[model samples]
Target chain A: MIRILIFCLSLLCCHHLVARKPEPEHIQIQPVFGTENLKLNTYYLLNNHTDSILIETLRFYISGIEFFSRGECVYKEKNSFHLVDLAKPQSLNISLAGLAGLEYDQLTFNLGIDSTTNVSGAMGGELDPSTGMYWTWQSGYINFKLEGHYHSGATKMQQFVYHLGGYAYPFAGIQQVKLPCKPNQNHILILALDYLLQADFSAIHPNIMSPGAEAVQMAKMVAAQFSLKE
Target chain B: MIHVPLKLAVICFGLAACRSNSSSFEKPAEWPEPVYDFSKNPLSTEKTTLGRALFYDPILSADNTISCASCHSPYNAFTHGDHNVSHGIGDSTGTRNSPPLMNLAWHTSFMWNGAINHLDMQALAPINHPDEMGENTAHVLQKLNASNFYRQLFYNAFGDSTATGENLLKAIAQFMVSLVSANSKYDQVKRNQASFTAQEQNGYALFTQHCNKCHTEPLFSNFRFENNGLPIDSSFNDYGRMQITQDPQDSLKFKVPTLRNIEFSFPYMHDGRFKTISEVLNHYTSGIKESSTLSPLLLNPMVLSSNEKVDLLAFLLTLSDREFLFNPAFAYPKELFLPAPKD
Candidate 1:
């Protein structure tokens, strides 16, 4: 009967190309004002060549937005965590293709806040540590609070502010960043806090709210700001 | 989002609904272990009568003329006695000196320089202090949800008629944990039904040898933060607990007051400057000031005599109780705020 209907239409087109699934990608760290403004302002101070010193307020926060296939690690939580905040850049355009664990490689979380959300009481957007970034009085949670007033030249031009946060134990804000993607499919990462004064931390100790150990040196000056545009 | 509740009902519709105090009774025996954590909001009795009617409502003060009994006044013991400061709302005052809300369940921290670490958020620092009770916890929860007796006493202690600032700081931590004073007279000499009198037992053996290592006794206050030496009021340059822990070793310290009712919490430290506890035992036996942050038990200097400051003011007037200072179930409920206050 016509060669058994051409072997069942080649086994239903190889089960619709191995159950198509891909969609998890996003990369919008846009904030340029130097190297001739390509446009994206919330006070740009981007960084590069690993000297990382992007100032004028660049924030960070990402958590398990995961999705992979080949290297494992399937799709993640309902809305795990993501607080970019250039004050609010329309939720930084992210899109990770049709996910379902297809050999994934990188993109883990935390550059701050992990004392189980500081005793887990009251939380809204921008991870609401009551957004004074919390330090109403000698307590914790100030993973980072740059604050401005730069300039330190010849005679009297100093007004720097740096309210970095702490988690207390000798003070901690445990930062982390990993990049490299696609074993099966899905990836997107771009956290660029200007470049955090090229990781020198304005020669260390600008300002910190509370926690301990000078917020572990501003979480190693915000994990040296993070790169890899791929 | 619990802020102005209808301009807080044209100034507290007579402290709407407040009258709950039963303290579920059994908190008696030896008493010293509370530091307030009733496991994050427990004690009921309609949340201590809606936190003693939002602590004597002047709708928690903004334009409704002060009310945290206008500066902790459960008649001198909740303490505003002889006003050494603490005036608030148009009467302005305060640079420090109100200190007298009783036993705060025992206190791990709360102002006088501890700065609110949680007595359920210390009535949101005097209800949003522009200068204490300037009212604004989402407009004091829209003036207790435009009171129908505080939405039925917050639907009988939080079944969500909604007043939130965490249930108005857990209904003022259930009327300051029903202001438990533990039936004073040193709790009737620890319930041996009272004894003391040998000039209040030589002022309780010179207050357990110079204030039991920072007032520690049946809840006298081992809450620590010393520096008792005074001297520094250059017009309230008050650096108590080092202006909230910028920490120069908690410079000019503070915290430690609870001598229970130190003869009606008088005008003492934190800028009420010795308004007599015999000028605070003559400045702890002749005004000390070696201060590298003092208090190694006031760093040596305590002479007394003059009948030991009248037997330490007769053992601080036996930490007064008057049934917890005339607690007409913590008065002013005037059948839910009417025209009382004639006294």
Candidate 2:
């Protein structure tokens, strides 16, 4: 009888240990130009398929990922910062662990690094200054970078480069994005580059390197392009 | 209940160990809390020693010709003496004067125009500037990784041999933030350990009346970007703070520099326009070119008699901290750099 009781208690302890382990969840980010996948150096038709744009570089930061269920936060990813680059295929897929059994229907994240992290000196991993996403002339992370050439007509192809970032007042460029998601399912987040290309390039100017009113406006346009892939 | 006392003792021991590890950086009792956050990058002897080596290493610059100390020498209180502007890699001359690097823990921003927001990020400006070090952080990391000496230093400082940008910048910041200059005779006078001469006392009074608003006492700088009414030098076309902020109102504005070690840090001003303190005093009295954004404190004309200028100069001399200038700990680490470590 004593041996049987000890066996049952060991079984219960093993079950508890198994229950404490968390399962991994993946978040895949897909960058697209219109309905097609984004390809660097490939010209894509824009503005009712009239103007053509050739993307040379596309890099941005995604940070502060959090999940919500029933209007309450269910899970927040620790050290949630990822640098997604068009050139690096592996960076597009982000694996989040220790989120097993989490009931989350909504996802929220910052399109750029937060102000607190910006002021904090020197960070490793995706937020590292060596990533080239950081502004060297000034001390702020470049939230979104898109460099390419645009051709409209008989005019020469113009280069359009947008490096958007600023943490200070009157021009803070970080944008928060929230999307509805199905619980317990791997998520696919789509970033549509067409919406950003649709803007009148002449009025906005093809070159924006520093953070200012133009950067803030451009960041807002870019932030609006993120959506959950159904 | 008996175990609780043992736990308390363990906690106390842990706290003591932590304190000893970070004791490399100390805050003076009279000064305000430092602007640089210490908790993020705690001070340690190994890290600071590594930082000192990096500060003197030319590998940070392109062509390995110039280091930070080239432009910011300790003898001149970190400013390049006799040079109006900074001379960089390939003999390139920069537009603005290289500012001194002391009491940096108190400064909230860096550069003449306050371009850098943090000390860790400040080195990036010069390292990448075409007219300065002319090297990118990525290449610098590759070079550092290739060097066995740097690898060992990195291992000692960060407990890893690989040279990452984060650790590199943090190590450099440790050396910079450790440069605290609070041991001047002026400070001693405030501490009641010394007294100022009658001439210095008169000069101190004059300084309080004329310059104290901008160059405040103790740290000797309010650290605000103010247009001090100097006419723009069209050659450089440098708009000072306006270049950074894109605000027309900030035109001709520059960060107010600390008055400590004013005696040795010659050729003053953002452009190093004045060669002597008397010349600087002359600018305040007669050469303030009025502008839309001129500092309000300088809005009124300042008139100092020649004798009063002499007295003020005497008071400024009291700010020169010989101990800080000659501190062997702050000097070049020859033992670490010479006779390169074997791989």
Best by DockQ: 2
The model with the greatest lDDT is: 2
Query: Per-prediction count of colliding residue pairs?
Result: 49, 0
lDDT of 1 by residue, A1-230 (tens): 88889888887888777665334545554533344322222333324332222245545555555543454666565545555656666645454454444455555555666665654333445654334454444444555555554333323333345666555344556676655655433233444444454446655655655555666766676666555455
* TM-score of predicted chain A against the true chain A, for each candidate: 0.31, 0.86
Each candidate's DockQ score against the native complex?
0.03, 0.73
User: What TM-score does model 2 achieve against the real structure?
Assistant: 0.90
TM-score of each: 0.34, 0.90
| Per-residue lDDT of candidate 1, residues B183-211 (tens digit) | 77868987989888899889888888877
Worst 10 residues of 2 chain B by lDDT: B1-10
Model 2 misplacement above 4 A? A1-23, A47-51, A98-100, A151-155, A202-204, B1-22, B340-343
**lDDT computed for candidate 1:** 0.64
Taking candidate 2, what TM-score does its chain B reach relative to the real chain B? 0.92
